[model samples]
Target: MYKTKRTVFIFLILLISLIVLTACNKASSSSGDEETSKEDTKEASTEPVELTIAARAGSMADALTEVVKQYEEETGNKVNVNAMPYDNLKETVVLDVRNNSGAFDLVMIDDPWMPEFAEGELLTNLDSYFPDGLASDFVQKSAALGKVPYETGSTYAVPFIGNVQMFFYRNDLVEKYDIDAPQTWDDVLAFAETIKDEEQETFGYALRGQRGNPIVSNYLPLFWAYGGTVLDENMKPQVNTEAGVKAMEMYMKLKETGPKGVETFDSDQIATSLTQGQVAMTIAWPSWVSEVDNKENSNVVGKVNFSAVPSQESDAAAMIGNWLLGIPRTSQNTDAAAAFLEWVTSAETQKEMTILGAGAPTRVSVYEDPELVEQYRHFPAQLEALQNSVARPRTSKWSQVEDTWGMYLSQILAGQLDIQEGLDKANEELEGILAK
Candidate 1:
């Protein structure tokens, strides 16, 4: 009986030992599998992706190139940048999309072209990529411009440049005239008149009145401030209304104090005139802010200050012309492109980009960052203008409309057509164009 009891005890011990050994083996295998899986994921994420981007050429593009360099280093990715003139960007991207050629993984777009791209289904729905929706750091108007329906549609892009027309003037000039900063259209006109009369060497204003987009973009702020709109609520032509006539007259009056050959001044000429200290004041974009302060490019360094467009019967309103970044639907590496997009537009990245002289920050927080504010004094006013700015009419046909209206407006500016007659003719032509 003692021997049988001992045997039973040994048998039970052996069974327990076997169970322990199996459990150890299973745990070891599981741990090995987990480690291998993690390593695989790491390898996949670190795999090199060659991303291509289409961007506008200039300092803005230079800024992006710098950001791309930082991104490549951080992620071990390769990037190819294609920077072209602004005039060619739309056509190039559109061709790539229409042909379903995945030549570019990302494209920087002007806000006005969002409608056409969205309508054509050329861009991916970026809203789905961000599980919680876009970060709320962006200014409302600037953010809205990236949506397909302006305020309501799914987001197809993110605002890459915080662009709004800002009213810039020489602070020293204003102080010298003993005039408080112009707060209204009347104030702006008065300042311009005083400067033109007193400062013989300096033109009072510098505005872009060149044919086509240049003249139209510069004029629209004044048009809206005077309660003039290109179209009424029903989308009918209203450019010949009383408000339109008044806005045009005010614009011409302001232009009278500008340089000789004002009718030929485009954005480049306007920016040069302002930085050269040949003009006392101008309504301009933040893209020129750096040039205005650079000692090499500007004679008015440390003297220029920016404000919102001057108010009139209506409160001040700026024209928002933000550029956006988007992924094309034909892109094979949407994930990689999206990663770059999110990284570039983040508040932290934007602050860095601002320091690098890229486009203006699209984030309100970036604009408000203490260090950034110190470096860019106009940031506060720029944020204010961006928040209050209005978009051009949200029509797919705006390009055609602008071409037609701009031609007539240019004719009027050159004394080739009377203001009222020119406006009536433009209204008629725009109606026909929109109808088609």
Candidate 2:
């Protein structure tokens, strides 16, 4: 009986050993396969895609970097950002996109450029790429800014920056001067002249004197005030008419009260000059005014207050300049780019952006945030202006028009040509463009 029991125990031990060995081999094989799959996924992503984003000046690049870094950490992708100054973008963007150099995978452009870029099919239509697409998530006006107009269409770009021209002045300065906030465009011109003649060292106004975007930005308010439209309802050049002539003449008068080197003025010059208290009142954008409102660098903090642009007809007609985000046709990472844009434009992200001064939010919910209302007392005024805000003529020919009119304005301001003559020259150039 003892011998039989020993035999049974020996067989049991041999059977257990064989099963253990088989289980170990199976686990080792499974582990090897998992490692192989992981290696393949890693290799597939190792192709070294460097997404180059070309943009104009604003706080956009900084805000995008935080999101991009998080994306890179999770997905192991790389992003390279090129923050181009506003002046160089128009010329460089066209060259890079047309050449198909795969140089810029993403680009930030002013809203006016959308018609041209989208019509040319230079930017990829974002509809095919974005997952939760533009369905009622965005405000209508904001959404319209990104779509191809007058046609049922998909998104061509995302509105990342909501920039509108606002009028700002020093409350303390106005009170001390016994000046009521100028209610009319004519009042503004009169105040500007008083500051120029009496203030002596300080300029009545600090205007953007640089050509192209800078000059055009400064002149548009005057154009609107004088009842001039860049393009009529029929999209014809109405820029040299009686209203247009009056607008150009007002621009000439602005030059008379401006700083000595007004021709060289740009955003940096205007912002610093305003905060330094050299300027009494000026038509500035949210981007520049934010700089002056900053506690760290601003001298006019708690002293500066903003108002709507004084009206020539109804109110000062400030031009709306929106910056949009879009993917390029050559982008290999369209899915990722669209994902980022959707997230960034979301209400939650836009609130965070507002706190960081990334730009204004596109959503009505965030725009009416109580915290923002406390911070920006002019929010009510701004909201009204935004609702009625004028977008530049939605045409593919804007790039050429901006250049032609911008050059003509510079010449008029520089005294190289009379206002009428300058507009005459601009009209000829525009007529040719219209013909083409």
Candidate 3:
């Protein structure tokens, strides 16, 4: 009886030992599988990738091309850039993503088009990649353009070009007129009048008076300063308000101070006017800053000075027109694209871009770089303007609104429609557009 009881106890101990060994093996196997899976993922992510980017033509594309060259050299990746004009690029990007074609791994976007892309669910949710959120070194307003709800919401893109409207004037001319830098629209008007009357060789101001985007852009700073809004708190058009009419009146008055055929000037003409010393003052983009200082292109090199736009009832608010980089939802190479974006927007890369004369820097550090500030004297003012900037109304219908509003603004400039009639007509058309 004692031998049988001892046998049973040994048998039970053996069974328990086997169960413990099996559990240990299973746990070890599971851990090994997890580690191997992670290694595979890491290997895949590090493999060289071939990517395609749809980039806007001109300096933006040129800058990106240079950056891509550096990125390829460092990562052993290959990138093919298909650069096209703005409208064509936008159409291709939208169509490719909408159809799930996966033709572009990445694309450049104008800030205003972000809403359309976001609303259509066409961009990847970038929040996951940026686990800690965007770095604070990025200009808040410029970086805000990447968000769907303007300054708030999940980021879908990063600002690539820090293009903001800058008030450009010939410092020599302003000083010659014995006036302080024009701090208010009234001040600008008076300065324009003085330059127009006395400096017969130079117009008081140059206006981007062409219809559509050009005219609307030219008028916005004025409209906003006068407390006018494209859309009120309720998303209603208020372009014909008391302030709007006053702004328009001021806009027309400024036109009188410009030279003949002011109704047809666009960016090229505006830049030419300022660089050639034909205009004493104008609102221009940072893209023109190089031209203003290039001795080969500018007659007034070292003479033009930039500042924030003049204020009125409201504080000065330069319009933010940053170009953004976003990965498409249909992209097959999103990881690689995100990597490139992270690299490009870095302070170091942006500084290189600025040095290459590609585009304006979106980073505060890059803008404040002593070397860059020295080369581009407008850097300081540009930084200030970017910080104090305002984005256009965050509506997918902004293109339509700008179009209708531009048509009337052009007419108002040409005397084809009176100010009140033009504003009323534009406001009505904008209402109809928003309703849709």
Judged by TM-score, which candidate is best? 3
lDDT (0 to 1) per candidate:
0.88, 0.76, 0.90
Q: What is the lDDT of residue 319 in candidate 1?
A: 93
lDDT of 3 at 215: 95
Clash counts for the predictions, in order: 0, 3, 0
Over 268-370, each residue of candidate 3 has an lDDT whose tens digit, in order, gives 8888788889999999998888888788878998898899998999999989999898999999988888988899899999998888777588899998888
TM-score of each: 0.88, 0.76, 0.93
Between candidates 1 and 2, the one scoring higher on lDDT is 1
lDDT per residue as tens, model 2, 1-436: 9999999999999999999999999999999999999999888756545577887765777776656676577556677778878889866777777887667777888888888887778888877765556756455566678887622578888877777778887677567678888877788788788877877656777778788778888888888887888887777787788887887777768778877788778888888889887887777877665677788888888887777677786455667777888888877777767666676677777777777767566677777889888876666556555655677888988878988988988888888888888888898889889778
Give residue 55's error in model 1 in angstroms: 1.2
For candidate 1, write residues 1-436 as lDDT tens digits.
9999999999999999999999999999999999999999998877899999999998778888888888899988888889999999999999998999999999999898888888898999988787676888888788888787778878889988888999999899988878799888788888888889999789888778887898889888888898888877778888898878888888888888889898888888988899899998888998788899999879999999999988898888999988899999999999999998999899988888888887588999999999889988899999999988999888878999988888888888888999999999999999998788
Score residue 105 of candidate 1 by CA lDDT: 95
Question: Which residue pairs overlap in candidate 1's backbone?
Answer: none
Runs in model 3 lying further than 4 Å from the true structure: 1-35
Cα RMSD of all models vs. native, in order, equals 5.8, 9.4, 2.4
TM-score quality measure for candidate 3: 0.93
